[model samples]
Target: MIIAVIDGMGGGIGGQIVNYLRQELPSYFEIYGLGTNSAATSVMLKNHANKGATGENAIVVSVKKANAIIGPLSIIIPNGMMGEVTDKMAAAVCDADAFKILLPISPENFELVGLENKPLMLLIKDAIDLLKKEFNIK
Candidate 1:
């Protein structure tokens, strides 16, 4: 399965998702770090995403080709994050039948840097468990 991690700036949330997936589920999954800008993409690349892209258009184009998408729900909001993640981004993720794994958005995390998406850690494990059970991972 190809999972795309979408993000705008910083990419902390997206990168963390990749990290968890890579460490826990490496059997047949490919993680793509999809960023709306170069900065976001750089962060994800460092986290070891199999592929990376930047810019709204670029992200829309590439993510449409991915199998699944994982990130904060805000990433797909229309004109969101200064247009870094536009409606097109949202469409691409959805049209692909890409199962979405989202991190909840809170004022504290949105305003603070490095606050981390605590729910992501929880969701990743549970999501993987469900996917594994459904697909028979082991």
Candidate 2:
């Protein structure tokens, strides 16, 4: 399966997700690091993403080939990630046919109510768990 992990800014979150997923998921699953910038893509690649690409166009094209996509909820929000995510990037991700696993974490301007404010690592773990269940892994 092809899994795409998208991120922006420092790419810390995306790197962590890629690291954890690489450790937990089967090696057969291909992980693509789709970042809003080169720094972000580099981080994910260092964390073991099988492939890496950056910028809006890369994101727009890669998501189409992904079997699943995981990232912060901001990925679908226009101008999210401190304005790193563009409208086209967000629209492409939202419109992709792949299954999405978005963390509830949002930008400062947006508040996602009714959900506990968990740590970043926990949120990632929860997302990975959900993906595992969806694919019948384990």
Residues 10-119 of candidate 1 have per-residue lDDT tens digits of 88877777777778776568778888888888888898888887876777777666666777767756666666667777777666666665555532235435745566
Residue pairs of candidate 2 with colliding backbone atoms: none
Candidate 2, residues 50-135, lDDT tens digits: the string is 99999999999999999999999999999898899999999999999999999998798888889998999999999999999999
My TM-score estimates for the predictions, one after another, are: 0.77, 0.98
Error of 2 at 136 (Å): 0.6
TM-score of model 1 vs. true structure: 0.77
Candidate 2 positional error at 9, Å? 0.2
In Å, residue 62's CA in model 1 sits off its true spot by: 2.2
Give the range where candidate 2 is weakest over 10 consecutive residues by summed lDDT. 104-113
Prediction-by-prediction clash tally: 1, 0
The runs of at least 3 residues in candidate 2 whose Cα sits more than 4 Å from the true structure, single-residue gaps closed, are: none
* Winner by lDDT: 2
In model 1, the runs with Cα more than 4 Å from the true position are: 106-120, 130-135
